[model samples]
Target: MFTDLALGALGHPRDLPTALELAARHGFGGVDPDVGHLRGLRSRTQVQELADDLTSRGLRWGIGGLPVSLTAAPAVFAEQLAALPQVAEILAAAGVGAVGTWVKPMDDALTYRRNWRLHVGRLALVAGVLDDAGIRLGLEYVGPKTFWSTERFPFVHTLAELRELIADAGAGNVGVILDTYHWYTAGETPADLRALTASDIISVDLNDARDDRERDEQQDQDRRLPGTTGVIDLSGFVDVLVELGYDGPVKAEPFLSTLAERPVDDVLAEVSDLLDRALAPAQELSRS
Candidate 1:
C-alpha cells in the first residue's frame, strides 16, 4: 500500500505543492490534493506543471474530490455534471486516476427512499463522466450511527449497502473508499473485509478514534492519529488489506482539532511516525 496524506484532515491545510514537499520530506509515497486547488488552476499547462513538480519531488498524486453534489436537484445536478468534462480533462492531464466524495446520510428534506433512488441515478451519471475520462469514482459511506438517529431510517452505512448501491447504479468504474475509522465505527470485522476483493476498494483512509468515546459518540473531527489510541484495530486492518492484495493508496485522515493548532512539520512528523507503525505489518507482508 502507498502511504498517502489527506490534506483536508491535516489540521492546518497546505497547498498542493507544499503538501507534496512535506509528504516527500516525511517519507510519504503520495498525497490526496485538495480539489479546490486543482479547480483553481487557470490552464492545462499549469496542471501539467503541477504534475511535473510532483514527479520531481518523487511523490505520487493520489485521488482528488469531485466538485459536484450527487444528490442535487435534476437541473442543478445537470449543470454540475456538465462541468465534469473540463475537470476530467485537467485530471487526465495531471495523471490523477480517481475522484472521491462522501455519501451523506438522509435528512428530513430528503427521505431515505427518495435519496437512495437519486443516488443510483446520479452516481450512474457521475460514473459515465469519469469512466469516459478513464478515471474511477471512489464513493465513501458515512458509518456513524449518530447520523442515523436524526434520519430514523435505513441509510447506506455499511460496505454491503454501499456495494448494493453501486450495483444498483450500474456504474462499472466506481468503488468504495474504505476508511478505517468508519469501518471500526460500523462494527465491521476482519472477517467482513475478507469477503471483499481488492478491486472492491478504490482507496483507504487510516485513523484512530478516542478510546474514551463510544462508537456512536465519536464526532467527525474527534479522531486520533493511527495507532495513537487503541480504539481501532489498525494493525489487523492493514493485515487484512495486505492479505487481500490491495495495492492502493492508504491515507492518514486524523481530524483532531489539536493537530491543527500544532506546527505543520510537527503534525506531519507525528502522523508519519504513527502511520509507519500502523502499516509495519503490511510492509512485512509485502516483502514476503
Candidate 2:
C-alpha cells in the first residue's frame, strides 16, 4: 500500500550505477531492467554485483523483461520460454520482486494452449525460484503486435479479457501488469478500470496519449506526458485506481526516443513535473 512510483530504465544508461542514479534522482522506488540493455553482463557474478549495487543505492529491483515477438514459430517461442529460468534466477539473486513479459508475436489460441502450457511449465520451474527467493511474475498484455496468431488475446484492450487471463494462469505468484497506453488504444472505457479487481493487477506503467493518434501511428508516443496529447481522462483513471485500492508503484514509461537524447536531468525533472501535475486535484477540498 506504499505510494511508490518506479521510473522505467528501458532507455536510460545501461551501466548499473548510472541506472541507479537515474532512479534515485527521479525518486523511483525500484528499477525495471530491460534484458537487452544488460547485454555484456551475462555471468552470474556480474548480475549479482549489479544487484548488490542497486541494494547499496537503496533501490529495489522490480522486474526483468525482453522485447520478444510472440508470433514467431513454436520452436522459437519455446526457446524463449526456456530461457526464463536463467532470467528469473538472476532477478532473484538481485532481490527483485518479479519478472515481467509481453506476449510474443506467435502467441495465438493454438499457441495460447501451447504457449500457456509451455509458459505454465516454465513458470512452474521458476515459481520455486521466485517463491524461495520471494519474487512475483507480471504478464502484461499489449497490442496485437505483441501476439497476433490468436483470434483474440489478452492485450489489455479490454479489462474483462485481461482478468480472465489472470484467473486462467492460476498462479498466486502471477498477475497482470496494466499499461495506460494499451488501455487507451484498446478503446476500453474508464468503467473497465472500476470493475477491475485489485488482485488481478501486479504492476502498473503510466503514460499519456495524444487524442488524434491511433495506437499504431506514434511509434514511440506512449512515452509522452499524461496531458500533452490525448483526451485520456486522467482524473477518471486516478479515481478508478483509488477505488480499486491499488497500492503499487506508478512507473513512468515513455517511449519518446527524443526524451532520451536530451539531458537526463532536464528529462527527469520535466517528467516528474508532468506526472505530479497530471494527477493534481483541479479544486481544493476543505478538511473534515
Candidate 3:
C-alpha cells in the first residue's frame, strides 16, 4: 500500500500545488486534492498542468469528493446528479481515478429507512457517471453511536451494512473507503478485512481513537495519530490489506483539534512518523 495525505485531515486550507509539495516533502506517495478549489479552471490544459506537476514531484493523485450533494431533496439531488458528468470529466482529465464522501449518520430530518433507500438510488446514479468517465466512487459510513441515537430505525453504521448498500446500489465502479477509526467504532474485526478483495476497497484512512473513550463513544474530531494509541488494530488492518493485495492509497486522517492547532509542518512530521510505525509490521510481512 502507498502512503497518502488527505488535505482535509490537516484542518487547514491549502491550494493544490502547495498541498502536493507538502505531500512530497513529508514523504507521502500521494495527496487527495480539494477538487472544489479547482472548479475555476476552464481549460483542459490547466488540469493537465496540475497532473504534470504531481508527476514531477513523484506524487500520485488521490481521491476527492464530487461537487454534487446526493443527500438533498429530490429536486436538488436531481440537479446535482445532472452536473456530475462534467465533474467526472474534469477529474478524469486531472488523472484522479476515484472520488469519495461519507455516509452521514442519521439526522432529525430523515428516517433511517428512507435515507438508506435514497442513498442506494443516488449512489447508483453517481456510479454511472463515474463509470462513464473511467473513475471509481468510494463510500464511507459513519460509525459513531451519538448520531445513531437520533434515529429510531437501524442505520448503516457498520462495514457489513455499508457493503450491503454498495451491493444494493448495483454499481461495479463503487467500493468502500475503509477508515480505521470507523472500523474500530463499529466493532469490525480483522476477519472483515480478510473477507474483502482488493477490488472491494477504493481507498483507506489510517488513524487511532482516544483510549480513554469507549469504542462507541469516540467522536470523529477527537481521534489520535496512528500507533499513538491502542484503540485500533491498525497494524493488523494494514497486514490484512497487504495480504489481500490491496495496493490503494492509505492516508492519515487524525481529526484531533490539537493537530489542527499545531503548525502544519509539525503535524505533517508527526503524522508521517506515526504512519511509518503503524505500517512497519505490514511492510515486514510483505517482504517475508
Q: Sort the candidates on lDDT, descending order.
A: 1, 3, 2
Runs in model 3 with CA error above 4 Å? 285-288
lDDT of 2: 0.59
Question: Against the hidden true structure, what lDDT does model 1 obtain?
Answer: 0.85
Top model number, TM-score:
1
lDDT of model number 3: 0.83
Residue 5 lDDT, candidate 3, scale 0-100: 87
The number of clashing residue pairs in model 1 is: 0
- Estimate TM-scores for all models: 0.95, 0.72, 0.95
Task: Estimate, for each residue in 1-288, the C-alpha lDDT of model 2 and write its tens digit.
Answer: 221334344244555567677767776556666565454566878777887777776776655663233355667756765665566556666566766666442423543466556555554544544565566767766642333424554323345655665556566777777777667656666787766677667777667766675555533334466666655666677667666767555666767667767777787767666665644442121111
RMSD of each: 1.4, 5.0, 1.6
- Give a tens-digit lDDT track for model 3, residues 1-40: 7788886776855888899989999998898867776666
What TM-score does structure 3 among the candidates reach?
Answer: 0.95
**Regions more than 4 Å wrong, model 2:** 1-11, 34-52, 66-83, 104-133, 143-157, 214-223, 278-288
Whole-model lDDT values for every prediction: 0.85, 0.59, 0.83
Single out the weakest 10-residue window by summed lDDT for candidate 3.
146-155
- Model 2 is weakest, by summed lDDT over 10 consecutive residues, at 279-288
